[model samples]
Target: MKITSTKLIAATVLAMFFVNNSAKAQSLPESKLKFGIGLDGILPVGNLTNTANFGLGLTPRLQYGVSENVAVTFTTGIYHFFTKEIRIPSGLPGQYNTMENKLDLIPVKAGVKSFVSSNVYFSGEIGVALQVDNGGGGSQFIASPGVGYAGDKWDLGVRYENLSKTGSNSAGFIGLRLAYGFGL
Candidate 1:
């Protein structure tokens, strides 16, 4: 995976969001509604790394607290990857053409987060990833599992994501997320 300067800068900015919002974690307030923004570093692994390179993206989310320890969230994000062009030979001899690959991934998902401790939580989300510029397939199912810390108004988490078709190729990656929440 290529760790470009842009990716590092983005990751740093996202981390700052958490730090800035967490300035006063001495008291954790209870809120019924919260909004969050986050950044993710997408490292393609397993079969996914074979075709695509690393990616970076942003996620903005909204959550409604169902109880003191549980919340339901609606999330969406865009992840961009780098891929090489594909060359296909025409029927004519000595003729070849290239196809473009737009490695943009957009995922719209909804899930639940369960807080096991005051500062620790586990979450799962399911949705479809829309593959922009994919000729053969335009969409694939995605499932993500995340674990992280939660504060009165901020959070930090690590997540694993899977994107795939039932009988086709699959992609996996690990991502880090930092988010800030506001009480309703």
Candidate 2:
């Protein structure tokens, strides 16, 4: 089933409220710097689904705790999308030719992570995604909002990311990230 943005936001808020109310409160890491690397899997949505079957990403992030329950983050990543084969009708009857297409992107973002409970957090980011392919496509603006579980050394998150450019349709995906973090 397709998830609408309103539903996603409502779900996240409900989860945060329940977790915060039911779980024992714990302190967030304060005044500390941490680094993490994440492996991401994405399912193409919206216009992206037309061309890409799936995507994989490698992202590295740096976080600095600014308060008891808030952190500022910088993240960069490379994402590659595996595309479906496109079939074109050949001159011969009942014959077709297939061509493969792929897309590569580099994203740079800055965001904030806010802990609601001890181990659950909400995050949001805004950035630019630069398309690096033979087509020489330009950059697009990106926005992502997510919710996650963060333990001492591991984190798992789910997010919706949208990329858009002027005069063009938007593209997006629902993504999951698994990461390992360490204090720096």
lDDT, each prediction: 0.72, 0.84
Point out where model 2 deviates above 4 Å: 1-28, 91-93, 135-137
lDDT of 1: 0.72
lDDT of 2 by residue, 1-184 (tens): 9766556656655654454444443233678899999999999999999999999999999998877777888999899999999899999999999988868999999987778878889887789999898686689898888989998889899999888889999889989999999999
Top lDDT hit: 2
Looking at model 2, the pairs that clash are: none
lDDT for each residue of candidate 1 in 1-184, tens digit (9 for 90 to 100): 7553334434443443343332322213335677888887777777777667777888888888766566788999888877667778988999989886668878899987666656676677789888765662578887777778888778888877778777897677777887776666
After superposition of all CA atoms, the RMSD between model 2 and the true structure is 3.2
Supply every candidate's count of residue pairs whose N, Cα or C atoms clash at under 3 angstroms. 0, 0
lDDT, candidate 2, at 57: 97
TM-score for each prediction? 0.72, 0.84
- Name the weakest run of 10 consecutive residues (lDDT summed) in model 1: 19-28
